[model samples]
Target: MNASLPCVLFVDDEERILRSLRMLFRGRCEILTTTSGSEAAEWVRRRPVHVVVSDQRMPGMTGVEVLREVAAQSPATMRILLTGYADMDAVTASVNDGEIWRFIEKPWVARYLVDTVEHAARVAQHDFALAVARLAVPPPPVVGNAPIAARIAVLDNEGSLAAQVRDVLPAAVRVEHAFDLESTLELLADHDVAVVIARLSSTDGDVADALKQLKRLRPATLAIVVSSLRDSRLLIGLINEGQVFRFLLQPAPRELLRRGLAAALERHAHLRAQSDLLQRHAVDAPRQEPIATTTGRLLRAWRRLREAATLRSA
Candidate 1:
């Protein structure tokens, strides 16, 4: 195996599938394949694997469980879930537990698969280097001259959800309520929000689009989608495009919401401390607005301004 090439692991019960993947990435990556999820995860713990692409269904251990173990053992390694079936439970579990970098549908385009894995490998290299550096000389938690209260923005038309989120979070964590897209944008612009809890099927606008836009502008701001919508395609979009931190069903238990918010806050703080990792959460810019209205143009300009500010700061 070439040590210079990025290391990639593929997990699948099918021998032919593994063989095909090996052939596909033979020259480009240092490829490893396994028919068992447990073995794949053990390999991750034993060595530095830049990327892991696993099929969802297996006889003993599923891909979600495998990726979850890999995440616990080596978080810096990027995860990609591959499956032909649209198993909603598997997809949701992968997002909440595995924090996969991308959800690639099985029978994937060869070119697309190659490109995604290559990109993830490069990012994983950076992440591993940062992890090593942090271990050697860990930076203190991000704080300034004065304590800045991490803001949480809730984009729910009903005041009830916002109130619920506020009640669970600490008093020090300010929670802002936004009833519509305009209000949400304004709140995000004025405050350095650490987390965003939004519905997928908001009445005011496409909440997913708003979340993607917000992530593009503020890469460190983590988003948790709490919606009744149970569309696998939409969830995959959130994973690939927005890189949403968590997804919860509507009317989630208070304790669940609390735990999710706490994790988001911790992840937010980590991103702030390691700003370079912000690139991991970058989203694709919307190619074309659903409508070419003034609001859309305003959003474009707003995004441009935010990008300019980010560059100047950098």
Candidate 2:
């Protein structure tokens, strides 16, 4: 292996799978294959690994558990969960606990897998460099007890999600509600929303596509999707394309919703404190397919927002 190639670690119980992955990523990355999830976690702790791709159904520690440990040990390392089955619990845990960068299904297209790993490696390298620089900087002084007032948005056709957010969050946090794409874009344009709790419509892809565009325009603003939709593929798409912070089932439990909101708020604060950290949440570019009517209108609205901002500045 060349010493200069970006390092990618693959953890799967099957030796054949490891061998296949090793062959796939041979020339592009410095491949490290291990069947033991524990060993993979240890490797992340001991060295500078650019990325870790783990199988979900491993023996000792599940992929979610391994990625969670990796997150704690080395947050700069990009994490991906590659599994044959779409285990719902694992998928949810991957979002809430592991916070993986992408979820790739098994029997993946060879080119797509390679592209994902390469992108992750490049991102990890930048993140690791940024982490090192932060260590060298003097820490900021701790502020007083006053909580920073921030705005939250709820993009749901119905008022339920907004009401839920209002009930769960403190009164100090202003909650903005938007029922349509135009309104949502206007709200985002006017306010620096720290977190957005958006609904995923079961009937259309418009909501998901809008969320992805929002992330691309504003990486610092965290998004939590609350939906009744149980499609694992859609959730995975949100993870990779939107970098969605969390996915909550409809009628989310109060405590879980509260915890998710708190986490999103804390993450937003961190991003605000260090803008460069936003790159860690970078999402993949939108798909090239033709846009739907709703999403096309959304694009126009977003363009108008940009024009207004530019005019104000000028």
For each candidate in turn, the TM-score is 0.91, 0.90
Off by over 4 Å in 1: 141-148, 202-204, 284-287, 290-314
Q: Worst lDDT window (10 residues) for model 1?
A: 285-294
Regions of model 2 farther than 4 Å from truth: 139-147, 288-291, 295-300, 306-314
Give each model's clash number.
0, 0
Q: What lDDT does the true structure give each of the candidates? A: 0.83, 0.84
RMSD of each: 2.9, 2.8
Q: Model 1, residue 298: what's the lDDT?
A: 53
Q: Candidate 2 local accuracy as lDDT?
A: 0.84
